[model samples]
Target chain A: MAEPVHEIEVEIKNVEGLHMRPAMQFVDLAGKFDSDIHVSNEEQSVDAKSIMQMTMLAATCGTKLRIKAEGADAAEAISALQELVEVKMFDETPGK
Target chain B: MEIKKGIAVSPGVAIARAMVIDSKDYRIPRRSILSSERTKEIGRVREAFDNAVAELTELEKDVAAGESQIKDIFAVHIRYLHDASFGKRITDFIENELVTAEYAVSTILREIASHFAGIDDEYISERAADIYDIERRLLTQLLGDVRRGVEHLTEEVVIVAHDLTPTQTAGFNKTFVRGFATEAGGRTSHTAIVARSLGIPAVVALEDVTASITSDSLVIIDGNRGVVIIDPDDDKMAEYEKFSRELTEFEVSLGSLRDKPAVTRDGEEIQLLGNIEFPDEAIMTKDKGGVGIGLYRTEFLYLYGGSEPTEQDHYEAYTEVAHHFEGQPVVIRTMDLGGDKLPYAGRQAPETNPVLGLRSIRYCLQHLSMFKTQLRAILRASVLGDIRVMFPLISNLQELRQAKMILRDVMEDLDEYAVPYNPNIKVGIMVETPSAALTASLLAADCDFFSIGTNDLIQYTLAVDRANEHVVTLYSAADPAIFVLMRSVIHDANKARIDLSVCGEVASEPEYIMLLLGMGVRTLSLAPPMIPEIKQIVRSVTIKECNHLARKVATMDSQRQIKNYLRDAATRILPEAF
Candidate 1:
């Protein structure tokens, strides 16, 4: 049986948006999970665990992103990645 | 020698060896590796990654320990290094394209960085610099060649760059970076503002500053002239060397003039006083050849101190300044607040018309207790030395009399305590407004002397709100209307036999000093640094020449003509200062 896939839609909340520094933090965090994580903007989808690919998304402030995760820990990946995009805003400066 | 002319954004001259920085691609020539060397290329790529990551981690550690704000930025760079795909992409390129490790790293990183640069969003586009920075680091390790940025500069040098972003310019160590010349940026660019605020000499928009200068090139950044000379010839070098020496010698000579009197060649004595805000500036005034304090602004005490200043706070500052020139007059101008500057603690309701609102003496009269606190301090410090009181923005005789009554009330209260004070401290009014200047003869009877505050006098007489940029152009010190008011005020003071001095922006300016002297005005209270240069002008010319110039200026109808004539006249006398 294949591992289940879970996904959630979240908004980039930080004013700096998904720039290099925040994107790097997201990819670094994704690399720690036991799942394959991918993030997609309206134009394209890319591996969330790849900083190079994540930067290609070019998601600015308020850009909506759909995060999808697949593995035995897919649920955890979905929630953590969603929290990063929505709650933590990848820990970038706010009101910038 | 090659001379490049550019817009001078900041003023000063700097001579130093050039330090070139190219922010773009390293321009590594493309070279192919033998297919057999694929393994070696991949190994080189892997090792470079490891080394770069180690270097970044070490920097991040030091930044973390040193309490730097950039530690998070370094962490991001480290994350890029540790990204699995980052290492794989370069290696994959090296293997597939049969290219050298350096070439593969440069091309792959350039591809990523260019994507960022191509983005339309400004914040997103700026990430391109970081990608370039990371690529430079990796290439530095791969090619075993050291990269030089302004941060790595250990010796004094003039930075020559194609373009410097605001971020890069802000990080420069001012001690080692004496000056800079760039190919891009206008006078009002963020880079120029930063350069000016940092007090560094910068000339931007040179177009070829970076291309013409090399690491070994000796460059002269003459920001005053907006000229950058690269590898100057022997003759040009000697000229600049003499210029550099003369500049230093001029500074020393200005200092030596502190002892010289502010008297003209015809034996006419001119009283040169200093305008100050704090006590320390009194000492600087004396050092700069000022005979006394002309306008001792007391608002700084109320504005800077967290709360309302105690009487002691006011007394201490006055005593320190008054003792600096024991016998000379120290005119303490009462708090001139609520115009453009308001007390920081009170976020007062925004007035529809701030300049016309209650300010200076008007504000003091409304807040009588605050007024009395400052008066008691002034009266108390007066006994310590020759301290005189002055009121600012006195528009009419009624306000002057009201301020005098309060001063008398405070003096009486001091007498109740048997305080040792100057029972007869002389009082004066700043003839700054049209009402005061127009009615100077009437107000002179109530005060001991008059000080023409030309800044506001010009503003009020011209009906030009100087703080507004649109009308500020019309606010001219050399305006025929302003000179008319000045003539009236000076004539009245002479007739009344009361001392008069000019304590405003006009006094510090060299172009107006001769005119002030020519107008039969013997006293000038100006910025301390201006004392020596103004004295130089006084000593070089006679009162007769000044009168002749002033007469010519009076005949001029237009402000532009008067200003040009004054600048020409002053510059002719002291060409070096102009």
Candidate 2:
């Protein structure tokens, strides 16, 4: 039997794109799910739970990323992680 | 006069033109060095890094407690501050290129900053600013002059630096520099402590003081009141001039009391002494009508020079002070280093509650070799003058016995080597904790004399941390409970026939002088500048009057009541002195 897999694509809304702090927040959200999540940009794909790995992707503003999850909570994880990229306004409050 | 308030670090008054020296403007002269000098260069780099980390860590704690927004910024900065990669890279460059560590650090920081700036991401680009701030701070440390921008000034001026390190304060030219004002520092900072020792007026933690006050602006620093006046008008200047004249007159009057005995109206003689730190300060003891050096803080031997002081270093320092005082009793306090004192490199573990943790005599007992070295040095220097060895923060008689045992061992070593010392040198303990005060009778039997350090005794009894801003309101030297403890200690010491003295700042005030005299304390040790006024009060008031006031004050419940009563009594007794 093939494990269930769900995927979604969302644009980086924050002006800073995947900066250190925002990337850390994204990794923290992904870590709360029971599913294995991976985020991929145009050049590379990395585990969403690792700040360094996600930073390596360098998903800037207006850039698109494919978020994939595989597990029993694949659908919930994909939707949650996608919501952070699509709707969560990490950029609403400016950084120093 | 435009007055600015800051935390008072040292006491005095100074009128001088401002000399603003932003340490950020400091630039290192870039040059290559020989391999033979690499070792020293490496040591410099390590020290600079260590100091930066310690400084930033302290700032981080402050920021985290309040401003949450900037706390994150410091978080990121501190993370990189301790990054192994950053340190390793700098050390590797210094060793491999054989260049000065200053040059290497500058080059590496610039390269890293440029790399971050070159990134397309704005978040990464802004990190370049953090790198720059770090670079400047590290460079400032490497300059070896915490006074980076004005290390070699020619004229007299009030130094206005962002902050001063112990090193910068040490390098101050007393002849040229009138005083100092800093934008960031605390009352307990190493710079402040040094300033107090040097008797230089200083005001610290005046936010943006360096930025607001320009160089060449006429200024007056009243460190006693913690006020700084920049660019005073004619009216204000006239008023200050009159004030200054009166001050000089008052100082002359105090000098007149130098040769007078501190005898009460009833013919009760009191032993007045000065508490000192550096060896040069011993002269002030005699000038201030002090008959002896009551408290010679020895922590500076370990603190001033980042490295641990050698046995010979301790010997020379003790011998110098002993010579300066002639035959006056010089009380050299052993290393009170662990808590809020010397932050010796690689020795103390980071303490959570330092005041309650390993400190003073306890720390000395743990580190026996360093303790023995100091004891041996003090014993050796005893022959030069009337010297006394005082152990600080002794909690119980067992600790005293343990300390005395170690002293005995060190004395035996000196005897074996045929070293000369005063065999009957008086031994004492600083009764700084309530536990020691409660059991003073027991401890009094073991020691020759007792010096009540009311500062810590009050703090411990009240369960208050004096330095903690949030709980500082609860710390009071005049609290009724403190009086009870002090009375008990005084009674016990008197019963044991052991001489006792009050050496804390509480003893320096005229109000406390009367109260302490009433409590049967006959010896007083305080800061040199305070001795004159206190002595003047002692000379006028009778022991009978003081005892009456003390009996009344003991019944007061609140600190406010006790303070008000003492204030009125002091004024009534010393109308001329006031």
Candidate 3:
């Protein structure tokens, strides 16, 4: 059986760039799906579910990210992560 | 007499014996564990990790709910402890490489931190600090016997440290630790905030305080001026001793004046009030027999809490202090901010000569909306207790009229909105500038009361920047020029039939009490700790004698002559005080 793979690209928009807080949120979201999620910049890729690996990517504001998910839940994982990066989860003020 | 300067984080002057606190002395042993002791070494590492996690969890819970940032920092520390990669790396070094748990942990963390330090992104690189912090905590746990902190002080001493962690600062012993000076910290650092909340004098950001100050050497922490003096000569020591004795003796004798009224022997009553920066300080005011709050510094509302406070914030703060007074006048000064006290750079325009430029009343006038918000809040707070709205640094009648007009506008808006407020809140002005002092009669005609701000008045009158050490010697409140100005202002206030008070450092000393009393300042407001001493002097002197002393000093031509005369008069009247 072939595993399904879903992929998407997101540009960082936060004023402080892709800092610890955003990376933490991204990892937390990745942990929710039963997929092997990988986030990457142009030069490097890392496991999205690993905080240390995600931090090692060192992405900043305006940096483009390519997210790939591979599993039965790959589509859902990719969609949720795309939405998180687009809406800038953990960046915007709460209740706004 | 080598003096070092840092940011003054807390107030008050403390002179005590110095003690060095160097947490770096907690060294870790570098030895390989034998294969036979592998199980024990593994157990030791596991125990260290378990204890570290438990301590962090306890620390997270112990932190106040408002300090969420600190809680988050502790959370990161816990995460590092639970990190599988970090644990595997350390365990591999201990089991396969034959190294001690302490050495393995430190070496692995150091390598990881150095790797992070090479990251181009600042946010990613700063994670190196987090790694270092976690490394130190784990090392401390692994080498338990070598732990060092302020927890072991046995006697009162001034702590000189590289820096203090929030946990260590929180556990400071007030009885054994007179004060603390640190090599790193800004005014808003956790150590500074905790030191201030504890009412302990602290000077931070002194780059080499710990290295320069030796243990058991006499040291002075002038938190008020942000200056630290180490190993003073005999002359300087004697001077500081006399100054310390006056404050200590005054505090000790305060108990006697608890039941006594602040009245002259000639039966003239005087109001002795406290100058407070925070609402909680009102408790000290009431404890020290302060009849009212003469100067409620409102600038702290902006400086503290990490943001510009809203109208609701000001209202709540003013209401809390007002409630403490129980109808006694709580004179709230509108934001006397600028110069070195500017909180945000973008909010205020930068100036070359901040002291002589946009500051205090000038700043309030320039920023009318901000000023009106404070006025509206103050008006709303007046219903809770007796609230007097006082403006600071009003050098001209126009500034007063403009400020009063804005207050009127705020009151009208509140009325239109059907909001409740006190309509007849007493309005007042601080006589801080020479121009303000000269025009005291005109200001008194418009204001309901007057409070002389001798600190600024002395600086402005002598054309001296009080903070500039080169010219600070010339800045004297006891100057003959100040005496002349005080006499004129008192005469004007008397003619205008408005209440006048002295609310400055000058009013705190017993020597200046008689001179101010002679100058017809019937009310005195100072730091809460100085109230009892001033009250004692107020109770002992006759109004006639004070008047004579004032008259004699007013004619003196020099600061020395005036100071000597006042000292002689103070000794004669209060022999026990000398």
Candidate 4:
């Protein structure tokens, strides 16, 4: 059975924005899921599982990105990515 | 079989096996593969990616858990290595383009690195280093031990590269990596600074060091002369061995002069101070027999620290030098940043002639708040020790007056906050421009002292750009015109009864020292490394002899004749040096 695709929009919160380390963390977390995940800025969408594509976003602080996941675990992927980008800010120190 | 000459950024001699490295993208010649060999090339690509990921993974565990910052750096490397899209790009290039795995990897990585380097965003552009680092790892795996470096090395080596990033230079294992040489770099490049701090010998700006040298061959890096000799003949090797030994002995002999005073044979006392670019060299200056810091350039602080440094940053750097000189006078030059060195925000339309444009005092005047911040910090640290302030490239009286007026304003600000400072802080201006030299008497009346910056004075007086190879021969500190300017400034300083010092390249040079002393310069401000040798010169010569040599050269019309006379006089005094 085809599963519903879950999607959410979030803003980068870290002062340094989505740099290499943060992009790597996001891609790593995305790799752990069974869902096929994709991320998009206003311009274009890319595979969230690929760090090379993710870092090309060059998303700065306050740049909005839409994350979508499709699979049985699509809801969990969306929630985890939202929390990482919005809540955890990829665990980057605040105001550095 | 070849000797390459470049600019030496550090001092030492190193002989070891050569490990040549190429940057992520530049100058990799294209190599092709047959269609029948495509499968093997693709297999090699997969193996290289797997091997690179394993290497980084092993390194990640070696890093301690508490050092998450370093771990994160490795994590990014590993993620790039494991990135399926990146691997596919390489393998697909190998299959479709019929190229060797190494060539495919090089071309693909080069394209990506150049793309990142071209990006306008600083954060994204800096990732070019990461791409380069990953390319190095994968290429080293595919090409084998010839390109291997740092953590993979089992024997001592001298790194030969087309170019090296500061990160790559800093990551070198001090014990196994004896030294390094590169085809491209400069004296002030971050890589050079790291090499200096690591105390490793490095030569840079070579024509092509990586292309000439064979892998694991015996190589010699003479950083003292900025020469790299590759696969020397036995006789040449033997000569260098003796030369290296003599140098070590020579340095030890110099150390013995540390306690001796820089007094001429006839009892003429001269102060040999040091010109330092960074605060860390303060101790070296004092240790090498510098009486004080004659010129502590603040340009590094201005350009470094990624944005304009805060007041605390200024204070901290100043105090670090002040702490080294307890009660000894340190002549701190105000920010002498060039027009081209300004931040993106403060910059204007590009000037066609930056050297003669808004720089030094002009830059300070336009950016008043930044200027005041530095002045306040310098004044705040003035109370710490005998800290004196000097302005640079002051071509006219108006600039000098304006700079002094700003200093007074900052002092008043400190007074309101009850922060104590040296109220009688001595102010001086660099006598670099010909205009300043000619009007020394006028400026000496308002300023506390004068320091002759011969480097620029020669340039401005002769109207020659030293960076131009064709006309640089015309630029000479010993030109009769330069002596005329020096004599005038010295005459003015003596007439006003103010302190005078020569804090320029001429001061450090042995050939010019006698002329400087004969021209009535009482203090010589030079690099710390040259202090002990200069002290030896001071101890060996009599002022009467210097005056006589000066007199003889003054009568000579030709600069070539003056240069020869000076060299003969200096060499006769110090036979071993020449």
The DockQ score of candidate 1 comes to: 0.52
Please list the C-alpha lDDT of all candidates, in the order they appear: 0.81, 0.78, 0.78, 0.82
lDDT of 2 by residue, B1-578 (tens): 46788877666778888866545454333445567778887888888888888888778788745686576655555555555556777888988987667668888888877766787888667767877888887887876543543556677788776676544555556567778888766554555655655557788867567645633478888777788888888887887778777777887887899899999999999999888777778877777788988889887687666677889999998988888777788899999867445645575557898888888899899989989999999999998889999999999999999999999898889899999888888999999999999999999999999999887888899998654435655777789999999999999998999879988868776777899999899999987877888888999999999999899997889999998888888989776544
Put down candidate 3 lDDT per residue, B1-578, tens digits, no spaces: 66898867666668888866555333333455467766766777777889999999999999999998788788767766766666777887888867666667777888878878897767668878887887887777865522233456676788777676543543455567887788766554445554554457789878567656533467898776788888888887887778767666655766778768999999999999888876778888888888999999887677654456799999999888888887798999999877345445355546787778888889789888888889999999888888899999999999999999999999999999999988988999999999999888888889998899887898789988664434555777788888888889989989999888888778776788998888888888877766776788898899999888887886779988888889998988777655
Show model 3 residue runs off by greater than 4 Å.
A1-96, B1-177, B180-211, B214-252, B339-342, B345-349, B576-578
lDDT tens readout by residue for model 1, A1-96 = 998899888888888778877887788788888888888887888988887889878888878889999898999878877887777876666644
Best by lDDT: 4
Candidate 1 chain B weakest ten by summed lDDT: B142-151
The window of 10 residues in a row where model 2 chain B has the poorest summed lDDT is B22-31
Alpha-carbon DockQ of candidate 4? 0.41
Which residue pairs overlap in candidate 4's backbone?
none
Candidate 4 per-residue lDDT over residues B1-578, each given as its tens digit: 78889877666788898876655456654555568878877887888888888888899999998999889998898888788898898888878877667668888887888877887767778888888888888887875533334646778899887776533543455568877788766553444544553456788877767767643367899878999999899997998899889978987998999988899999999999888767777888888888889999887676544588889999999999999888888999988866577554465788898879888888899889989999999999999988999999999999999999999999999999999999999999999999999999999999888999877788789998754435656878778998877988999999999999998777866888888888888898987877877788888888887888788877888778899888988898887666
The better candidate by TM-score, 1 or 2, is 2
- The candidate that wins on DockQ is 1
Q: What is the lDDT of residue B324 in candidate 1?
A: 83
Please state the CAPRI-style docking class of candidate 3: incorrect
Model 1, B1-578: lDDT tens digits are 79999877665678898876555443654556568889977887888888998998888887655564488678778878777877888889978888767778888888998998898888898998888889888877864432324556788998876666543553465568877787766554444544543445778778556656533678998866778999899999898888878876875887888898888999999999988755777877888888999899786677553478889999888988887888899999998877345444466777897777888999999989989999999999898767899999999999999999999999889889899889889999999999999899999999999999987788778888654434556778889988888988999999998989998768867889889888889999976766888899999889999999889988999999999999999999888876
Better of 1 and 3 by lDDT: 1
